[model samples]
Structure formats: C-alpha cells, structure tokens
Target: MPSGRPSGRVPTAEEGKKPGARSIPPGLAPRPRAVPDYVVKYPAIRSPRQREGYKGVFQDQLAEYTELLGEVRTAQRRLRETEAAMGRLPRHATSRTRVSRGRDSAFLEKQQRCEYLKKKLTHIKARIQEYDRDARDSAVYF
Candidate 1:
C-alpha cells in the first residue's frame, strides 16, 4: 500500500475474488476506433470489382482526382484542429480601431482558410465520384 491504492497485492483464486465490481475486465482490451468515412472514400482505387482501370475520359481529370485524394484527408484533420482552436478564440472584438488580441486577425484568416478547404473538399469529392461513375460506365472490359 503506497497510500491511496485499494490493494497492494493481487487476489489469488484460493483467496477468492473481491466483492466490488471492476470498471474494466482483467483480460479485455479496448475496442479499436472506427476508420473515418473520409479515409475510406478518399482512396485512389475506383472499385475492387472493376479492376480493368480508368479510361480516356477520366484520364484528363487525374489532376483533380489526385488533388482531391491528398487534400481531403489533410483538410479533414486541419478542420478538426481548427474547430478546437476556434472555441478558444474570442468572438467579438473589444474595440473598433483594434482587435483585442494583436494576432487575432491572422488567426482568423488561418481559420477561414481551413474552413474553406473543408468546404471545397466536399465539392471536389462529389465531382470526382461523378467522374468515376462516368468513367466506369464507359469502361471497356476485356
């Protein structure tokens, strides 16, 4: 007993189990967190079943596709961090001539850019998916 600890030694089978319920079971591990939808949806693959590959129509759109794939995940992560930071930021300025915080304007601009990326990502993802669908429809399977 170091002081506040309930027990210094483990109870053996011969000693019998403790009466009070434990918060977590002895052998159980915590469940793994689920993968976010953005990660799953942002993969480069068109589909597992349609393995033939992309066509000419979608070839020219590869720039947009790659950009979406890279940006969506990064934007998603930045958006989460920005959201927490946004809560700590002061909403109303104390005076008309100057901001209460000297660097508040810069922080606000960074926050707006993060939000813009997040919004742009949704539209990009939708456009990419639509292009993917069109490419798949016209794909020639061997």
Candidate 2:
C-alpha cells in the first residue's frame, strides 16, 4: 500500500527563486557622450557666450589666412614673369626701375598680408590653449 503524497516532487533551483530576483529596477539613464578634448580646450570654454565668440574669431582668422595665401601666390607668379622678361632682354639692357618698383610694391604688400595672417593665427592658438585649460579643470569636477 502506497502513501497518498506524491513520490517525486522536488523543486528546481530556478523554481525556488524569490520574486525580488525578477523585479529589480533598471539602472539610471545612460550618460551623454563626452565632448571632444580639443573643443573643450578652446578658450571659449570659459563661458558659453565666450565660446561662440571665439568660434567666430577663429573662422575669421582662417578666412584671412586663406586670402593672404592667395595673394602671396599671385605675387610670386608676377615676380616670376617679370624675371623671365628681364632674362630675354639684350645683354646691356635690364628691366626698368618702374617695373622693378611695381614688383617690389606687390611683393611688400603680399609679405605684409602674410605677416598679418601669422599674427592672427598665433593669437587664436593662444586663446585655444586658454580655453583648453579651463575645460580640463571643469572636467575634473564632472
């Protein structure tokens, strides 16, 4: 004669788990992507408005540099043409002073423009360094 109770009813490990195992809440929202280091390093990081201003300044400087480069190239081509013409002249004859003066003026103007561009580039680089330092300091707190 067998007992009325079931003979083989063992609870599996999974079946004996607590309700809390399935009810745990998810973690906090995902963190935002980090800003690039170079951008943060820009001097504009001092303030939002300053950052915008620096961007504008940097763009302007870049445009000026491009223009200066073009002007320098044009001047160089003209100088080369003038030199070629002088070479073709008679042995005793040379390019006139007026022609030389014009070339000199063009060269000087191009040189000045290049110098100005260099100065502006240097200033922008300094500002960028300042901005980067500020950004790094702020990031430490974050």
Candidate 3:
C-alpha cells in the first residue's frame, strides 16, 4: 500500500506550478459563513420599487398579482370539486328528466367558469410581467 503522508518539501520555481494544481497555505482554508434564517425567509424582492413613480405602479401590480393568484387557486379547487360532482352524477339518461338536465347544466356552467378563470388568470399574469418589465426599464432611466 502507498503511504498517505505528504513529502513536505517546497518546490523551487524551476520545478513549480504544475498544471491544475493549487498551492493553498497550511491552515488557511476558507470557512463557510452561516446565513441567517430571516435572510432566507425574507429574501429581497429585486423589483424597481426603489424609484419614485414606478414604486406605486409596481406595488399595484404586486397587489393585483396576489389577488389574482388567490382567485386562481380558489377557481382551480372549485373546478376540481365541480368536475368530481359532475362525474358522480349521471352523464346520460333514457329520457331527459328535469333533474338530469339541471345537473348537466350545472356541470356546463362550472366548466365555463373554470375556463373563464383560467383565461383571466393568464391575462393577469401577463399584465404583471409587463408591469415588471416597465418598472425595470424606468428604474434604469433614473
């Protein structure tokens, strides 16, 4: 077996600086600094809110984004529930009874609502992105 001990003689310049080799001094290795939990929890939002006019616009966009995000989540949950309910109800009948028709109509209504909410959410997200770009551009100018 090969010995694990270092042959501790410093090389002269004529035989030094081998390719892909490092020469870190003994006991001088860098230690990792510990990051605070608060910093991780509340990492800075890197938007253009530092500027004057763009701050309000960015804030408005952020607020709208939060609101729409909540609405989208609710819509998604309700859509799932509605779809489940629709699946539980009878899809076809021998005759078009009033109860069956009502159930089908309710299902169709929920499907329409789900589609509408999805489209609205997409539009809101696009607007938020546009506002973010605008804010960044304005900040660059100032």
Q: In every candidate, how many clashes are there?
A: 0, 4, 0
- Among these predictions, the greatest lDDT belongs to 2
Clashing pairs in 3: none
Angstrom error at residue 5, model 2: 99
Model 1 clash pairs are none
Q: How close is candidate 3 to the true structure, as a TM-score?
A: 0.30
What's model 2's overall lDDT?
Answer: 0.70
Q: Write the per-residue lDDT of candidate 1 for residues 12-45, one digit (tens) a residue.
A: 7645756674556667869889764545544454
- Tens-digit lDDT string for candidate 3 (39-117): 3432333444423333444456556656665665666677677666666777673223433433456455655555544
Tens-digit lDDT string for candidate 2 (1-142): 1778776878886678887685344585566897644444443345757767777877887887888888888778887887778779885685466466345776787788778667666666777677778777678552
Q: Could you tell me every candidate's TM-score relative to the true structure?
A: 0.28, 0.53, 0.30
Q: All candidates: CA RMSD in angstroms? A: 13.7, 21.7, 17.5
Where model 1 places Cα greater than 4 Å from the true spot, the runs are 1-103, 140-142
